[model samples]
Target: MDMSRLIETPLHRLAHGRTGDKGNRINISVIAYRAEFFPVIREQVTAERVAELFSHRRPTKVERYELPRLGALNFVIDDVLEGGVNDALNLDGHGKTNAFLVLSIPVWVPETILQLREEITA
Candidate 1:
């Protein structure tokens, strides 16, 4: 299908993510809300793309591991924490809010695949 015609929507509509951090590295898991949406995420949400999204954090490396059976993707980002929870000066240094940031990334999905919701129309 030609993706050019697809609508861009925040990832939260299709999936949810959680974050865990150890030292300067953070692990995030993006799981599709439905199996049908997995392929869309798998194709668009690459490790490089994710790293780009967090470019301000200056991650040294970003790795994505796929769990097709569970319709999920795990991302491990390195060198983003400034040291570790005990060492970083930021208020949310452990990076728990990073998951919500990831969920806000825009993804293009076929218009037909989306079920228009009243809330969105309003």
Candidate 2:
């Protein structure tokens, strides 16, 4: 998984949302670690782009946050799940549907990080 290629993939741009904040209409965030990966991550995760990806899901808001010290990017996505925590707990049939929904969306991670993990294991 080359870092450059991975960033360009359609899957990498999935699972994002748009901002509803006044005067700051465009803001987007994708989760990742490592400073080297931020440029590509930031470029692909624009608010407009995110809004398109999650248009069907229709979250209320999306905001980006930098956590350099933790080497992770945090995204605050509002209203992703309907009826919130209580709805989650009252899920039918042992939560398989909810689990499937979560698995359907792709999560982006740096290729360099994957390479490092492979090296460590090898």
Candidate 3:
């Protein structure tokens, strides 16, 4: 509960994501850069949160599949493409932007994790 113990950062700082799509469904895979960060990413990033992030797309469903060994979380978002690339009115209907959108999600990390970096470089 101590505010000083936490730091907010974009998810991209702890992980990377890739976007894919098929028949109006969007798939995003988020992988943590370090094993130590996996648990935090898994705990903070949820399907419900992801659906909220892409609410403008009005996704019909959102599913999150976890791969702990790989330190990754894969999200399958349905009906987000507006009817697929060939049919969606949006110019970038491929859903390529979804990955970056998800990555921009703010993540709260323990200040200790941030301190690790400073200790390494000092």
Candidate 4:
């Protein structure tokens, strides 16, 4: 693969995410900034990668649900909250940090997409 045209960026640059919780499980949704960017995000970001990223939290399981029409991926992570909201030690017991942590995931995209991102931002 030609590396020059590929731009390595955190997932946040290509997508935005939100998170919620159900007991100890965290539900995170990642939506691509552009429809064209969805394929790259889908191909690069996998449940395995997410599981690896949250290894410190020791999630029992990670499942990814794809919403192609919405250009989104929803990840259900189990047992990362230290317990349910009432029992969690963190200030944001809903595992609010999960989405930002997931966004830290790195992805490689073509230069054209990078340009599109800049345009969207601008």
Cα lDDT listed for each candidate: 0.87, 0.42, 0.87, 0.91
> What's the candidate order when arranged by decreasing lDDT?
4, 3, 1, 2
Instruction: Give candidate 3 regions above 4 Å deviation.
Output: 1-4, 116-122
lDDT of 1 at 7: 85
Pick the TM-score winner: 4
Alpha-carbon RMSD, each predicted model: 3.0, 8.3, 2.8, 1.8
- Which is better, 1 or 3, measured by TM-score? 3
| Runs with alpha carbons beyond 4 Å of true place in candidate 1 | 1-5, 116-122
Q: Write the per-residue lDDT of candidate 4 for residues 10-98, one digit (tens) a residue.
A: 99999999999889999999999999889999999999999999898799999999999999999999998987688998888988878
TM-score of each: 0.88, 0.45, 0.89, 0.93
Q: Deviation in angstroms for 26 in model 1? A: 0.6
Q: Which candidate is the best by lDDT?
A: 4
The ten-residue window of minimal lDDT in model 1 covers 113-122
Task: Report the candidate with higher lDDT, 2 versus 3.
Answer: 3
Two-way TM-score contest, 1 vs 2, winner? 1
Model 4: residues >4 Å from true position, as ranges?
1-4
| Residue range 15-119, candidate 1, lDDT tens digits | 889999998899999998877778889999999889998998799999999999999999999988876687898899898889888888899887766554223
How should the candidates be ordered by TM-score, best one leading?
4, 3, 1, 2
Candidate 2 lDDT score relative to the true structure: 0.42
Better of 3 and 4 by lDDT: 4
Which residues of candidate 2, in runs, are more than 4 Å off?
A: 1-7, 10-33, 88-122
TM-score, cand. 2: 0.45
